[model samples]
Target chain A: MTRNETVDVLIIGSGASGAAVAWSLAETRMNILCLEQGDWTRPTDFPANGRDWEARRYGDFAISPNERARVTDYPVNDADSPMKVANFNGVGGGTIFYTAHFPRLHPSDFRVRSLDGVASDWPIDYWALEPFFAENDRMMGVSGLAGDPGVPARDPPMPPIPLGRTGAAYARAMNRLGWHWWPSDTTVATTEYDGRAACINLGHCTPGCAQGAKASTDITYWPRALRAGVKLRPRCRVREITLNEHGMAAGAIYYDADGAECFQPAEMVILAANGIGTPRLLLNSASARCPDGLANSSGLVGRNLMLHPWPQVSGYVAETVDGGRGPMTSLWSKQFYETDPARDFVRGYTLQFARGAGPVAEAVDSLAAGRLPWGEGHHRAFRALLDHRLRIGIACEDLPEAHNRVTLDPELTDSDGIPAPKIDYRIGENTRRMMAHGIARATEIMEAAGATQIGVSPTLNSPGHLLGTARMGTDPEHSVVNPWGRCHDVRNLFIVDGSIWVTSGGVNPTSTIQALALYIADRIKQRLATLFDPG
Target chain B: METSQDSGLSALEIDALRRLAGVLIPPDAALAMPGADDPDILADLLATLGRDQARVQAALGALLAAGFAAAAPAEAETLARSRMATAGPEAGTLGRVILQCYYRDPRVLRALGQDPRPPFPGGHVLEQGDWSLLDPVRARTPFWRDDRAGAA
Candidate 1:
């Protein structure tokens, strides 16, 4: 290793959780530093300007993690999983390719076991993260209406996006069905805040946002934290976290841009890597002291992986919906946000109405589904998918199962020769029942809205929310980390990403993920007396 | 290209594509849409599908043999479906890529009531439809669960 550098706190991965912690701890005036594997890409680097933009999406900016295997991206073995572990690896992490749908976990999500008699309960509750969620809303620049009856009371900072044609149709249907629907809290800005301009209604939020309107960490927290003296280093892929004589996290050994190994010694080490990356690092860090892996004394470091399965429903309409305009998702419903004894499943799902993709994407989508014809019939299908369609994404909540997990792949390795994560995930019975209910209800809503040609994709696609690999709980015997995000074994080592979630909530997990990181930073600051003290 | 200079295909394939391009994207003077065989446009398309040279060349061969350039639109389509389109997944993929390549071109986009420019640097300005479409939802009562007690 090269010269061992030291800092008060060293955070691995600068994604949503990492950025939240960085921003939270920046005020502490500690020597805080964050290392990100991916480069801090510029606005122009996004492929939105090219004429071959839609086609290039399948190659370079593909939503599939395996296809976009940049040097910074680690390969994932998703052979067994129904849905892929879809997350980007830059400073913004999934925010780079996210739809920016910011929804908080309901009060029921935190108390799943107590409420539903399935899955373990989170050590904390929705009330505990409520203030933090509000804090993140302002920080991330959420544009939405307050007074969403299903959600707890909290006001957004800006006005909501106009409920365009798609949202209007879906909302009218929800009204006719007497279901709960509201304008969604998207991270896209309607008005300017913190020097970032308003969202210009760009359609391709999935391939990265060039307008800087999306509240990705690179634009939101990284610059502010850097201004606050937090050193933000990129192109440094961390190999493993090292331990001291006391078996505390001493530092991390990482491969820098030049492929040279260097040790970053820190008074405290925080793992902000997501569900897959965090477990991959720990499993790769097998030493004599912790043969099973550091913080794997419970043998739960890479267990209980939860990837929310996405089932979608779509329909064709006569009116022009302007689907490719504004933010992708405009309206959402929490009518089934909680479970009922009537349903076979214990958990629930959220419905988000979005536009069908661009003309090229629609052509490919129709071809894949065997709906669109080639030759002379192509033009009609293209126009129908483009200007005359409405789509709803059903994000179902996945319960944590010990067998469905992220294990270290024995064969696959990244460009750095680091062992990649192997995902052995299959949808549980509960999720299947939930999806059936969700799809059936969504189809009815589509018909109610006078939409013809309604179709349902029952199988799962990318969940986009990867949680519960290194879960937090009250008991050390069954968990990797404690309630405060501290590793049960290593005092200074903290995991503050979706990896530490006890249960995966139905809605998007970014708001909760960021809130937990901020909560952990508070816990770390409060416990500074024993944060660095050895047993 | 002058004669598929950048395309990995042979001269015969280039000549075939030049003939088939007119049939694929016919010239429309009223809409100012040029045929797909326009040299600059064909070059761009060749560049777009360059990643799979073998598959594209196979499809081009099949289409040429199926009288794609000489037959009527429906007849040519039937001929393609019966002979070449059934070649395999590879042929179907090539056909789709070629069709998208034709449609996404600025010339075709302008014919389909769209701006000639790509959707970046500047995006579309869409009109927000009437909010009265939400009056039904706005009139409904709140449907939230009473509390966690009901769930528990």
Candidate 2:
């Protein structure tokens, strides 16, 4: 078919980064449109608690990209990678079911090569992105105390959500160990603000949030961006980026919801389709000028994939740690966040305490551990999992390595006849050593906190936090995008998602990901002079 | 027993699955909830997880043939433990489906001190809890090391 409609800018994926950019650019009176592969999930869809709500988590709301398996989604063959790609496809993307854990990247994280000496240094430092972090915090309405001395100091808009019994127990343990522990800088609102209702401490933040307390972009950025005038076309899966004679991104060819082909032309194209998704689109867009893929000048479009390997350890605390109550995880320690050469690990990890899963989930955990017996002692076996359990997740920072990557699978394709992403990754030696140290440290903490019958789980099948496929760098010969998120080969094309990450920090990437999008959007607004220049 | 329009279990398989549920969920003091073999729960399990009769028959048949249903509680527990020890993911998935069906019941939630209905619309009124526990961590300085990703 002919071109559907022409706009000043066209964005793909309406997730954290996409929403940030869309909201930022909507003000310039430019014709902006975002094409999403999935439909919008209404808040009403996720009730606080229903009979089958917990069951539905393993169903439609399942975090596994393969398990949720929406029509717009393609199965990721992650045979080699320890964790599968676990994200959603809809308007808010994975944020729809995320914990809304918001944390800033440290200044050391940006200059890792200069400071830590392992990973590549980001072209832009934490100071350059600090203002955007604060901006995002204000926009998302973060909840926590501002004086966290871990990074630079900044106050959150809302007060810290109550630590609860579980978090408090862990804090005491951290204090006993003389370690650094703090309330998480979460995106969940404590009191009602910005039209959304207050979080009622409902533990089911993952399946979905009924109260708009969680700062998923659909409820935060979409509403504002829509009001500010950005055309949103959902269920439109972009197939490839079509280029003009001058090798600039002219538009994209996509398959509409009806399985019909459509083309939307634009002066510029922004790809916020995430780490896995951004590369999937790039690899699929093969043409004459770029025989390998569109903007794959360096053949690094899908290289250096990073999924923070999280090893969760749990034990029975002396006091009740709140069985399936409050938010998922509100307390965390960054004591091991910095790399210690004495520890034999290149980079370090973080230990965050979580109130264990719901009743059904606990039962499953018990069974998986082979601790829950058949007839008698079932209750006794289950008490540690349900009530007095304090769970800690060891999140290790994964370094970028060429061998660990996402590539196109020739044997498998999605429902839309597009090649699916196949992952080939393994945790490097640095990460493994870090994980072992973290687990040992975690075990010690659990023991010190008067916990009994402590159980440390094997490495989770999937790490879940997928990042760094289309990594950014200063040189065009090595990275897919530049530090500014602009494709070095295709000036008119930009990728503002986690794909542009130079290094994966030891914490969650959502907060940093969204901030980078805002930073890039401002750059595009200011650099309008040579945006469409043929030079 | 409440029977939905869709229960893909055969009469023989249902009988076998029903018998095995008793061993899976035994009535105890703390767990005042219904047993897995309870008629309503059995029907619910059959209606939901019994979609693939072949798979259900295979797993349940293995347990029954090993005298898991008719044996004493102690003996049945032994058989189940042995079977589970030898069984693969199919057995794990089978047990998960059974436990999932058993726990979804309202009686189970009441026994666990939780409201029976879904958690939204009217949510839990949990306490802000004691803050003294956090005083120690709050009193100390942040522990992030000045070093970035240390040199390779």
TM-score of each model, paired residue for residue: 0.92, 0.95
- Model 2 residue A155 CA deviation in Å: 1.2
lDDT of 1 by residue, A1-535 (tens): 7856689999999999999999999988999999999888788878677777777676667766786777788899998887876888887887787888998888878888877899878888887788888899989999888767777778989878777777778777887898888889988888898888877776777787778888899999888889999998898999998899988888999999998999899988999889889999999988999998889988888888888888888888887886666678788888888888988988799998887677677766666566665444455556566667788888889899899888888899988888898989878999999988999999999998888878876346665578898989868889888888999888889999999998887898998999888888888889887775543
Q: Total clashes, candidate 1?
A: 0
For residue A418, model 2's alpha carbon misses the true position, in angstroms, by 1.1
Query: How well does candidate 2 match the true structure, expressed as C-alpha RMSD?
Result: 2.7
**Candidate 2 — which residues are off by over 4 angstroms?**
A532-535, B2-5, B29-31, B50-79, B132-152
| Candidate of highest TM-score | 2
Q: Give the least accurate 10-residue stretch of model 1 chain A, judged by summed lDDT.
A: A373-382
The candidate maximizing DockQ is 2
What overall lDDT, based on C-alpha atoms, would model 2 receive against the true structure? 0.80
For all candidates listed, what's the TM-score of chain B alone? 0.71, 0.73
lDDT of 2 by residue, A111-153 (tens): 6777678879888877678799989998888998765656567
- Report how closely model 1 matches the true complex, as a DockQ value: 0.37
